[model samples]
Target: MVEGETIDTASLDGYVPFDSERQQAYIDAGYWRNITFHDVVDRHAEEIPDYTALVGPHRELTYAELAANSRRIAAYFVGELGLRPNERVVLQLPNCTEFLEAFVACSRVGVIPVMVLPRHRSAEANHVVDLTDARAYVVDYGRYSSGFDFVGLADDVRSSHESLEHLIAVTDGETSSVDGCDAFAEMRDERWVDKYGDEVSKTDVDPSKPGVMLLSGGTTGLPKAIPRTHNEYVFQWERMADAADVRDDWVAFPGVPIGHNASLNCIVGAALWAGATVAVEPELKPDALMAFIERVGGNYTLPMPTQILDILEHPDLDQYDLSSLEVLVSGGQKVPPRVVEEAVDRWNVGFCNIFGMAEGPLICTRPGDDVKVQANTVGRPIAPEADEIRIVETDRETEVPPGEAGELAVRGPGYFTGYFRNEKENTENFSDDGWFFTEDVLARRDDGNLEVYGRIKDTIIRGGENIYAPGIEDELVEHSKIANAALIGMPDDRLGERPAAFVELTDDATELPLKDVSSFLEERGIAVFKRPEYLEILESLPRTEVGKIEKQALKDRIVDAESK
Candidate 1:
């Protein structure tokens, strides 16, 4: 017999849903709750209308106001623009209260928002628009903070993608300058809601339907769309809220673009799930971030480790009243132990290391976890029963015993069923039975913590010895002179490939030679084969928008430099 609600996958377009057996298991285990994203907001609005839901550099919004604005915009989407349920819209905007408004508004009307990063150029935007067949393109075009014409980009996408029907631009000015674009204010105007409030209130959004589409961040190719149903997405963030011990009175600051999966799920979703307030700041520089946190009384934040290092390195760090910060959370890449150490020592705040992906699977260090665990491991799965973690051999047939590194494979309530519209990738990345091969290398400790060894493709083989790059990079950053480190396997004729170190020195340090790096690892008892053979001092490492090291860029640079 079918269990609980049967998801009609045909209606989802390219979105894959849990099968009958898996659906029953999740529902029986109490993991799958039939609830839409907006239900949570409406609940909070009714319970705490006067409570602050969101705060930005420009304005503050209470839960009642937030819900009212979302309902208003949602009414405009359906009643005025004629957007139907399940229709897709490309939402490209920076961090602000309006981003939340637009996101929840999409949820309220059962429209799916295709989250597009602010840095996405016409190439990326066009790719998303074409893939999703989005009917509307929403962008924040007022500030010109990045000095790029987002309106022009929208026009270019609308011209090429035949499915795009409407252009919505958010501007501070009373009127919109762009032709064929609607002002955002029209959608949220009080009068519009008063007219169509009854019609929007009667709309029914299925909890089992797709809520949002997150772009994949795979290293090799163009990003694929990751479809998350409302039930699963809600479950994912609620687990995060529980794991991080989020309190309703807390203020959350996410020092990354809201489009990133980590920022969306961890900071925004989890915080709001617990009825906490989210603090938004478009500027991510150290001083700006610190001042924003202080101004908003932000107690919890998730910034990439590099951002934390930058904050620690800032000359005016001591001047900022960051005493309100209670927890500093970081993820996406291996956080240096020194960074963790300094944060705890200086700020007296809890530091949590999280391991997650757009396709689900959230593992995080809790608030009271041992400092060594926080520094060295990305703690146990947040929901042990729901998020089943495994370390499997290269063949993907057998599980590796604890303490041995292998590919991380997961299959459970917390993982996405498959990538949207990519049948080849779906078959290749998932097993016949169901596991999603994460492609990341990890080793489980006896104590239940998991140590990340970086990506499986990043392994270096020197004279038949398999060496993980992240392990060496982790050790390299512990050196007094090194501020940041990235390890790449450089081409070598003698040994298939040799590990090379790309390092950024600390503020007070000078030059560090290859011999010094090798000797430091030797003293640290790192395996001789894992030592970096060559060293290159760089002013800064190339990174993605989310702060992950761009190793491919470094590899290309090293190859060209070696050839020259």
Candidate 2:
């Protein structure tokens, strides 16, 4: 299932059936362009030595500076600490300069870096660290609430997994901070020179070899590991960059965490791959992100739906200087068209609706897509290989009509090789015929545009009638009072599972009446059956590691509340 092995040169000629023939230019150029992410970094360091690679409020690292620091870190990882290729190095830090250093360093030296989201507490962290059999774990000693101690977490990981040995603490040492644990400053040594430097410069760097281990959010079970190689990553980046219309001078403001595919695949790599500047914002909070964007002189921004709503509703949003932001790319959640419409109409910016998951298709807005499609539609397949990519009938295994909603199954060059070493799960995830079932429902509009319906798994069977959640949530976000909305099915004694709307409200939410939501949806012609039977208001809806609305968490909260 490796990209190099599975996808032959001949098979790729007609690979992208859904895409225009113009996309062949990218593959023709990158086909044998075979360079690891590390190779790109090393090339950039030498070529664009003085250019600012990353800029943030906390620190600024140039291409040469970031590469130098990463080399020192790579030395510590390989020389003193004895890290090896194919070994798992768990990175559990928020968006910061350190994450970039460690992640790029690992890629350079070929040690597999598994991204550990900052939201994971000790228990959840331990579960993933244990499952991955990670040799080392990296974290910020003093970060966030919960008094999340790096030393304590390290000890817990060591106890849980016999393979765990190193626990590198960033920030705080003697002349620098920390007692027993290794100081991050020691690894950041300036004197260290490149040793496995060929690993970075060599064109022979195996793109088929495993490079990153992206963890599933444990939605169905404990998160399964998916290994992405260098070549597959190249394909992913080309497709994403193509979709985003990334130019050499384009600057990207990554609102999503860099570790996740949204930022890493599109923002980080797109910048490097296209020779553009990237502004790494710390949090998705509206003010902070826009402030960071102001400082970095950004041209492009990729914010989620809620983050957009926050900006649209922010009291002092008008104060920020966002005239430099030429493009706004939104993904990782369903975008309510109205929220996007308001932002576009008011802020004078067009919305790019990107839809896809880590394990499969990456549908995003392209240059040729109409303004309505760019704002309203998710998009068509952007891959050079798409043997099967469509919304098909769930009841009969038949391809649904263009406008009908059904499951999305696809297989292409950008698709993951397979889940990391999970044979049984891999067999089940992909169909026997070979298409990777996305478990998402989508509709192909009459104009050849694609609109995401909702998660097929998230479908609420209310009294045997299926109510897709995204359609309902989309209408819910249209109201001025609502910030974010998620609909989850709850067990009804009469109906198998009834749709429940879990909502997060804006600051001015107090004034809106309950009927306002229902009336708005009804006027828009949203079916009565799709209307939620219950509405739960919260400060915020729980999110997965990828920042997706955690409907399962809402379901648990409802059950817990009902039990009490």
Candidate 3:
């Protein structure tokens, strides 16, 4: 049976319905303007036709050009492809100008865009297709260097997924020879828009329904789908722009995949909302990124911790001119205090810590914050007056005392109410009153900042003692010889589990012994049991697609070594 058959048309299965009282309150307070992304793009195009809206390595588009291209694509989708309003389309493209155009076009025609990472293969792609009952799959042709044939992948998806009808390819190199596939460039034909522009323009758009679907970043199990309405999503970006101090004249660079929430909403969405320019780089190479920033006079960017560390340690760092960079924001994991200090001192740049999830409530350090606050903690909620953040016990209902460590639960205008189609998980994660439990363990500092201890699941239980991985990892990273550090719990015969250190050294020739590690932690006042018992040196740590260190992968490696 189809997924949406048993679900209400107005409130789809994968989409969580908004609370009526909160919705009305938000609308009345002017937090939600009832405006869609289509409205934002159209208004910008009319008011600032000549403003440069999107820039990539090879091409740049003005607001007027973006609007026209979106309209044409919308017309082709509706008129030629016979796509109905609210149909789901999977968008799996890299960071480029075409990604922006295709996404806006979906919004323009009332089609729901389901975001999928470009690195995702058949396993992930098929799951999304089956979950959403998607009608189309959009991808880029031969653009990635991963050596996988995207055309072949698309064909494979079409063959397995019976609901998917159209395979759209954005050609960068050679056009696909696939018989039924459509070229994305051809969809820009003016003739199609001229013939069916009126009908496509009249497509019914309901602000109450899901406009976009974002994938969760959980480390365990399949990623959950989180849907957000147009009004709420737009309000989120608008507020993010304000909090980040994104200006109209600033050029924003997004180094991560455009499909990720931090990249799409906090970086790209914020830039467009402020009438600024967005510079897109498909790859995250530090050398290429440095050149792009120098060439475009890029003023702002949001990068992961690994990217920042690479840029700081680049061999030819002095060769480029990156003086235009004013604000640098890092998220997706805890930003090492040493990395933050180095970036600010060497580059004379302002570093901000951004902590957020795909579900909602972004906490960021602002320009006016004290330097220590910026370095030590992820600052308070962006909209503290409107958003509610609580430190609660594991039961997720009882509130903990201030400055105590517990699970982080949040409720806000920008946060989603529940997971799409997963009522069982929702009942477990969310409270009866409306708080969405984030599973992350954080404590409120006396200065009103948040000190994130790792995830509740990430805690290493040795015998009966609970040891937070981030707490140990943070101390280990501060060591002069360690470049990066990750702590994972390995099965122990005596204790239930023991902490193991996976470290990437600053000098490859250097060797760090377990005794030395223990001495260093002792000097730093860390408890004896909390210190890691085993030390493994590696060239590098395994990271997720979004650049987070995958602890589960490290645990598996240790397990494999023991089995041998």
Per-model TM-score versus the true fold? 0.96, 0.86, 0.96
lDDT of 2 by residue, 1-564 (tens): 112222222321211121223234435655425667777777888998888877755678888988888888887786667766667899877677778788888876667788776666676678777667788888777632325675677777777788888887777333465655666767887544455433333312345566777766534446667677676677677666776777767777678777677777777777777767777655667788778777777777777777787688788988998777766778777887776677667756656678867675778776455666776898777663542476678743688988888888776556764676567776766665457777788888897778887777888998888888887887787777887888889888987887788888877766445566678888989888777777878887887644578777888888998899
Task: Give candidate 2 misplaced runs (Cα > 4 Å).
Answer: 1-32, 143-147, 172-177, 190-205, 218-221, 367-369, 384-388, 395-397, 479-483, 504-520, 537-540, 543-547
- Candidate 1 wrong stretches, greater than 4 Å: 1-8, 218-220
Task: Output the number of the lDDT-best candidate.
Answer: 1
The pairs that clash in candidate 3 are 14-420
lDDT by candidate, in order shown? 0.86, 0.71, 0.84
> Residue 427 error for model 3, in Å?
1.9
Candidate 3's TM-score reads: 0.96
Report the C-alpha lDDT of model 3 over 1-564, residue by residue, as the tens digit: 122222134635556678789889888888888877877888889999999999987689999999999889988888888766667888988888888888888887778898988778888888888888888888877655545667678778889888899998877646643466788888888998898888666765666556789888855567778887787788888988888899999999897888898898889988989989999988778998999999899988998999999999999999999999988889899888877888887877776688888898688888657667887898988778878899999777788887889999998778888877788889899877888899899999887889888888899999998899988888998888899999989899899899999999996448999899999999999988899999999999998866899888898899999999
The better candidate by lDDT, 2 or 3, is 3
Least lDDT summed over 10 consecutive residues: which range in candidate 2?
Answer: 11-20
> Residue 455's C-alpha lDDT in candidate 1?
81
